[model samples]
Target: MIAAVSGGSKDPQAGGGDGREPITAAAVAAQVGGVLVGDGSIEVRGIAPLDRAGPNELSFLSHLRYGQWFATSRAGVVLISPELAELAGTPSTRIVVAKPVDAMVALLARFHRKEPRAQGVHSSAVIANDVRLGEGVTIDPFVVIGEGVVIGDGSWISAHAMIGAGSVLGRDVRVHSTAVVYPFTELGDRVTLHAGARVGREGFGFVPQANGVVRIPHAGRCILEHDVEVGANSCIDRGSVDDTIIGAGTKIDNLVQIAHNVRVGRGCFLASQAGVAGSTRIGDGVQIGGQVGIGGHVTIGAKANLAGGAGVIGNVPAGETWSGYPARAHRDHLRASAAIARLAKIVRPLEQLVSKPFSSSDGESRANSRADSRADSAPDESGT
Candidate 1:
């Protein structure tokens, strides 16, 4: 049921310059192993949200919250989860799957744009006499390969990238444009340093002295294990004494800062703008949300989750969810927040009472009125 949509160079195939073939609803269903329903003949050329999808585009519904946009969607083909299958929708073509988002991701991998492979070293690249390059390496223009550097097979050093002296890059490593790999750094296989990423940079360490501050020299290496990807503009500082290591399969988002001597474990995900101070140890499978700041020398247990904007100053237990400033257990943080809100309500009336100006006359009047009311309510000495 594969259909071909006629187009020029605008729609290139994944990993190739060939024009993308038009995909039909039936083809998508087959690719995701989804149960096809309604019209299998519908052609899907692009992907979009349910509300924004057109007749030539595909859409997905993974969560019930987004089901609000389902009925009115003009999408030609809809890939939906089983739970959302019962919901009525306008799209005539449907692909029912266990995970609609996963299905969509698979389709995106098939059609998404990929960087064109650049083979051979550019004439403008400066390679040191002792630098060793493996088979099928691509060194783009303005790239500088320092002495004693070893670039493994199929590695790509993008334009303006600088590999410092004695650095080692494994097979299929990608150093994007403007990325700087400092001296003696080790990047494992399939490691990707995005544009402007600074790896193995000297850490911020200084000893305060009476005369002046003495900068501590960093002599340790920065090591990124296999499949670790550092996002654009992220900075990974080299250690002062111990090696700074990022474990295999860790994905760091843009603008992240990993300070000196920090050890991040395998399969950890660090969101954008997250900063881990020096000497911190993060266990495997940890998830750090955006803008989270971790203090120095702290240890985060494996599988611990840090909520967005959390200020972590202490260790987090494994598998626990932490949030709020001076991060604590998620439940405790919520309870503390609720208590503060309740306390605020209690304090408001007292605040108002204390804020009012006091007058002697008003107090005396109130006292007299209370006395009169008591007298009226009091029983007479004689029988009434």
Candidate 2:
């Protein structure tokens, strides 16, 4: 929350911020700690882009790419960065800031509206006799709490969410609708499981026997550290023997898959559809792009980056960027791709030559030779 004006308009109400309060350009500038260069009394209601903002709306100029739109903008007030503040713009009021984007984000809370969460457990929720719930917990309708489950204060279990037996959720943890927490799983404080997320599920481990295959039972827990957010429909499998642990502040996109015994370090960002095979260790602050595939037992060092669609088969060094199938260094991948393109260009001419028949000159020469051969072979017309 950014510091703002002490008091002028009505306080923001629950579920709707500034609905009855009229925000002015001065108030906006004061809230974001920006310099006011124009009319401070102009009223603004909502935020929009420069091209789309009307006379009552506030707009922002953050990047040079959007500077072109500023000249003809009709916005009543604009938050402009110092670099673009002197640029030609038509707005009546300008609030100059070092970081316009940050200022805009701060102002967003004033206009953002969200539904109020109801307090206390619903009548239809099912809680076991031994379940321990902390203060300010809100359990939605049809949510199931298994025996020995413990949820800390301010935790919210959405409708139809299931907490398995012996699972423990720390303070302010949120389990969205239909999300499942398997038995003995642990979620640290401020962790969020989005709708339909599955945590602590059994891994796909099987041993091939002569007659058939035998499934290995998973006996380990899945643990998410503080501030970790699991996206909707993502699956994190419990370890076959050891725990599957996600470090603090890691964010996983939708449809991600994490196999058993995998350990992810802190502050990693994994895009949608990324899959990590079993027993892989990913270090801190790693950025994995969309649809990247990491092989089993692999090690990715801290601060490593994996590009989209990369297929990682081995270890990745720290602070490196890797891409392509059988992922290598980014520069190496680029070189290989460039070489392949150049080779294709070279092969194209040869392919065309091979596909063509005899050239015009060759055809003419062959025809002349055939004519001479026919003339020589023609029976001696002299009748000698």
Candidate 3:
């Protein structure tokens, strides 16, 4: 047991500094200084969590709560904090460090290196007159840039992407393959549009008229602030009148739909398949889980957490956690669910009490019928 081990025993080794090379425990220690308690020559190929790590994977014991699972891990090497190293019982080669989590992050990046794209316009790319491409902007093959589009410096527009007229993309923006940006849209710096994402589509708004249902004209533009990332196939609609604004530092996962006139605050995290209806307002730092749906005209306060699969029809206050259909507070939903479960036990006894009288009457009727049949069979006693 490592319970009594001192800090003096920490064997700091350099971690994997060379990019894309399958390094051993010695290399890991060489890159990031940490104490090596086991075989430094063990070769590690990948990084993973403690529960899912294989024999060739490197894992980390970051939180003390996960120490229980560490005893049964099968990783080839593990990074652990000095204080918890003695308590951990994994058979894997242990690297006792000052911060296991930070070391893991550095090692994870080393394992996954990015492929650099060429910084220039492709030969087959089409550009309209008056389209402004800043210095070092890379346009991939078959990209269509519409008239009056302005792309900032160091931006990369991938293959087959369409930037509509009057759209402005800020510095260092990345529009992935097959993404579409409609007319009059504005994208801020360092924004990422993943594969097949759509921006500035017309909102679903109609007015009932005497002749027929008239489609509301979407006149306003869609705007995304700096450091925002939209996942694959996600869509953001243009506002009916006012601009649709997605605040800075927000991440929207795949298949998300943000309707027209929606205003999302900064640092919000919206998960995959989550949708916000038109004119809804989401506050800062809110966390919306996967498959959550917020109704039109609803306002979600700051720091509110909507659990996965929640359906919200009303407003949510700040810092509240909501769940379930027609979403309510998570704690209340749990309590109500528990109460409903208890009702099953309570209803069974009442049903038995209500049915007891009829059961007794049925038993009496059967007994009388048997007696009558016996009397009828005894006619020989009467000497007929």
Candidate 4:
């Protein structure tokens, strides 16, 4: 689901008109260094897709296949690539750019309205006595801040987020609605925790007891370096005694799970639903595919590529491609799979022979006859 401000003007050509000036198509062409074709005087109020755009809307043609609709579109202004300019016939106005899609994105961002929140703490928020908030911080309604928590400058805490005691958040960190940051967690600058993301949760560790299993105490914290992003519904568990660290510039997808003491290095891309067991160290620039499971205590070296649904049972060396369960080298796994296919062919004939019932003497005679037939089939020096 694409999360954005909801319940605003559904019309693409409308603006908030709150002292923010609207931009024109000619101004956009001049700023982006594009050529203006057709009518340069036509004005556009907002941006939208081709199908839903109205007379005041600004649309674009990126792919060549969609060029057919450009001539029939009622949009007041059209952003077109140089290759698509010929296909657009006498539109209201046209701005020719090298990349039409990128130009459209730039135009949409300039006109989008932001949801407004009061710049101070709301009456419904519950902040503990010992918590320290920096200047210009905004705490939305229903937000809870525990004791000894420190939130840096310009941080926005959405509704229903629970910031545990002693947790520290750096500047410009955005904690989405319903996200939980447990006790003693640390988040660096520009980190974004999507809605329902759980940080510093208890790791899955247990011990056998006389009556039942005893839950291990999680005494450590979770540390996320600068520019890290966690997707919605993902969980990162705290360590038993040491901090679980996710290095800078790592992007984790939705529903991912990182167990206790797992250290993920810088610039790693973890796809959706990927899981790493306890104490596993994943090296820098590693690409782990969706649903990949790495066993506990295993080390994955730098630049390793793990395919989707691959299960790692042992340590993987640097710069290797791995796939399949009990993951091996990709080439070796394919060779082993081919050998197994050939073995199945040989086993099927033997199974048919063994399944047939026969007398003991008949079986012995059949075995002797087969041996003689094999001897006769062999080449001899002279004909007997």
Candidate 5:
């Protein structure tokens, strides 16, 4: 029942100039243990979204909100959750699995193969005499290594990356292109600093003097524990007195800002555009949604979840969910939102009643006019 969905010649073996191997649906089923609902012999060359998948591409449907895409998608082959396979009654091949997104990720690793980089220092890299580079370190073009810096073995410093003086990076670390590592910063093994990530920058700390604000010197370092991954364009500031620490296995999303003296615990996931102000302590396994702003000196307990755009001004208890601006408990937020919605209905009628003016020829107005005339005829401040 499998059919080609796109307006292209079926070429499952097709690939770009790189060495990405094509895989058949039978192989994919064997790899991810998905139940094939159609022909298993069809070959899939690449992976993409449902709308953008070509004839030889494998697509996925995970979120129900994207069902419109599924209803109209022309993907040649698709992966669906086992529970939703009946909803996808298309002519294309379907692989039913428990998690469609996870399967698609696996297919991505297969199709978009990483290019092998050579292990050596590029000629354009500037290395100081006191710099210690371990075996198998790959320094790309124009990389600047300062004095007394130690880069561990099997690490890759990409093009234009600057490792400042007295910084230490552990084994298998990857500092991507244009990433800046400030002095005295410490990164553990397998840490990844993605493109344009600024580590150990000066924190935002100032004192109000008689004349103006005086800037405090950022003296302490920033420590990213083992297996940490900082996304592109994120900034981790150095502490004013104590170290700003990112615990092991934490993955930060793009455009995040971790301020001075903030301690983020292990395995925490911070979504894109999230910010933690200075001196905040986030417990382990906390999940922070996109664009969430955490105030300074707040402590979030372990496994707490902060929803998107939440402004957390105080401590959050462990295993609780917080939402809304100036975040509160999840149930409280829900009740408050419901109350506001109900009040909106009640307020609309009152607003209309207040806006309407009194009738021009009303009986009440006539009575008031007669009373004013009587008062004018009867009374005066002085005897006439």
Candidate 6:
């Protein structure tokens, strides 16, 4: 177990005790090739939200909604896109970039801990016989490598991770703390498995037999191509016959569940808690929002985006954005929502009209009778 650092320390700079030179905003701007619009010599100790940043903190502006805060933020420096540079006003230094959020992400990675493993393998690690390890591999404490496992060069396996027999990990791959890769799973170069990620797990396949329901044997593999990253606690099940494949540059967020025989294409982004049922084929550049559930045997075409909480039951064509429970087109869903809202406004009036004791003609007659009665009740001083 990794020892927890005590938070009781009063010193703000206590986190960095190595005596290394502190990173300044100018240094970050230089690294990302962004031009500094204000004082480049200012030293920013930490990064914070735009609204909560202090004098020693760095904040970012990427959206128009935060433009108001950017003008008044106490941050020492602000990273902003070229489009939002005017909003920063005077005084505050701005690092202008084409993509401010991406630049901010690069800066965060530079400041944060990049790798969990120490420089070398731990003393308590267990390596099985006939395991092949490449150069510059770092295995943390209590990690277990099964027999015939092959780890490529420049890979880092975090503490307490288990690599099953005959599994192959490519170069520069990172298996985070407590993550498990089952036997026969293959990972391409630069793959990242976050903490508690499970690869090549048994699929939910069952066959109803005469006597009882029998679990189907998962005899296939799970393959993650280059640059694939599995988020924390996400699970990728092994195939029933063929390999369940995750294409290059695919990113899956936390709590995602990918069932057996699912084929995910290149550059796909699956958000948190998104689930793809068995045998679903997701095309390239598809974006799945958080908590979206795709039914089994479905096919989502390239560039299709499913909005949050969408339930997809059928096939989706290319370049469409869908949302809502049944998952219709985004514009159609918005139109339906607007229609419902308008209906809500008129519903009370319709209800009152339907429940009224008198019709329109009866109302007119009553109005005329009241007018005649008021005339009769009036004084006859002006009468002929």
Q: Give the TM-scores of the predictions, in the order they appear.
A: 0.87, 0.85, 0.79, 0.75, 0.82, 0.81
Writing each residue's lDDT as its tens digit, candidate 6 over 1-384 gives: 333332232344533222234677788789888989878888777678787777767778889997777767887878888887887343378888888888777767544533334556678899897999898888888999999999999898988999999999999999999999999899999999999999998899999999999999999899999999999999999999877999999999999999999999999999999999999999999999999999999999999999999999999999999998899899999999999999999999999999988679998999999999999888897763
Top candidate when judged by TM-score against the true structure:
1
Report the C-alpha lDDT of model 5 over 336-381, residue by residue, as the tens digit.
9999999999998999998987786776889899999998899576
Clashing residue pair totals per candidate (backbone < 3 A): 1, 0, 18, 0, 0, 0
Query: lDDT per residue, candidate 2, 125-197, as tens digits?
Result: 9999999999988888899999999999989888999999999999999999999999999999999999999
Model 1 lDDT tens row, 123-147: 8999999999999888888999899
Q: What digit string (tens of lDDT, one per residue) describes model 3 on residues 212-317?
A: 9999999988999999999999999999998899999999999999999999999999999999999999999999999999999999999999999999999999
Superposed by TM-score, candidate 3 places the C-alpha of residue 134 at a distance from the truth, in angstroms, of: 1.3
The true-versus-predicted C-alpha distance at residue 123 of model 1, in Å, is 0.8
Q: Where is model 1 more than 4 Å wrong at Cα?
A: 1-8, 11-18, 354-384
Q: Which residue pairs clash within candidate 6?
A: none
Model 4 residue 292 CA deviation in Å: 3.3
Checking candidate 1 for backbone clashes, the offending pairs are 5-22
Per-residue CA lDDT of candidate 4, range 157-225, in tens? 999999999999999888999999999999998899999999998999999999999999988889999
Query: Model 6 — TM-score against the truth?
Result: 0.81
Order of quality (TM-score): 1, 2, 5, 6, 3, 4
Ranked by TM-score, the better of candidates 2 and 6 is 2
Worst 10 residues of 1 by lDDT: 1-10
Cand. 3 Cα-lDDT: 0.89
